[model samples]
Target: METVKRVLVTPEAKKVIDQLSKQHGKLMFHQSGGCCDGSSPMCFKEGTFRIGSSDVRLGEIAGCPFYMSRSQFEYWKHTQLTVDVVKGRGASFSLEIPLGVRFVIRSRLFTEEEFARLEPIQNG
Candidate 1:
């Protein structure tokens, strides 16, 4: 059976991830819940941003692990998140900000079949 991914990345976002990875080495992503960046996805160097047990590991995008706070996950659990890049600087510390772009999440609700085959989530 084909596994359904909880998180995905667009080609444009992948290019940005590759560029950032080349400079920063390993990278990871966190879905911010309406704080510094308004519900935007933040990128960080792996092991830099602290991931606590309260966070949920959605999946990987561009070889980097993606996560969300457990509280936030409660609301987004039924949706598949797509990491997309936009052409504007965001007011956050995400790596992409310096490059005049920010990582944003585009989500879609999963169908019953897709939900049934979703990849298992992990506790951070």
Candidate 2:
């Protein structure tokens, strides 16, 4: 069977990731359930943001591991998330903010067949 991806990245987003990775070695992304920037996927230098035991690894995009708090995952478990880049400055600590571009998520509900074949998630 073909592998199912929980998250994907857009070409525009991939270009941004390549640029950031060159300047920051490695990276990771986290989506939280809090207000403000917390709702958006925040990119950080790998190992900079702490992943908690209750966090869920949705998958990887552009070679960077993507995670979400378990609580947040509960609300998003049925959808496939795609990371995209947008021209705007977000109020957050995500590295992309400095470049005048912010990462955004574009999501869609998985089909029944796709949902059944989703890859398992990892904790923290």
Clashes of each: 0, 0
In terms of lDDT, which candidate is strongest?
1
Residue-level lDDT for 78 in candidate 2: 92
Superposed Cα deviation of residue 112, candidate 2 (Å): 0.3
Which parts of model 1 have CA positions greater than 4 angstroms off?
A: none
In terms of lDDT, model 2 sits at: 0.92
Per-residue lDDT over 41-63 for candidate 2, one digit per residue giving the tens place of the 0 to 100 score: 89999999999899999999999
For candidate 1, write residues 1-124 as lDDT tens digits: 9999999999999999999999999999999999678999999999999999899999999999999999999999899999999999999999999898998999999999999999999999
Candidate 2 segments exceeding 4 Å error: none
Candidate 2 matches the true fold with a TM-score of: 0.96
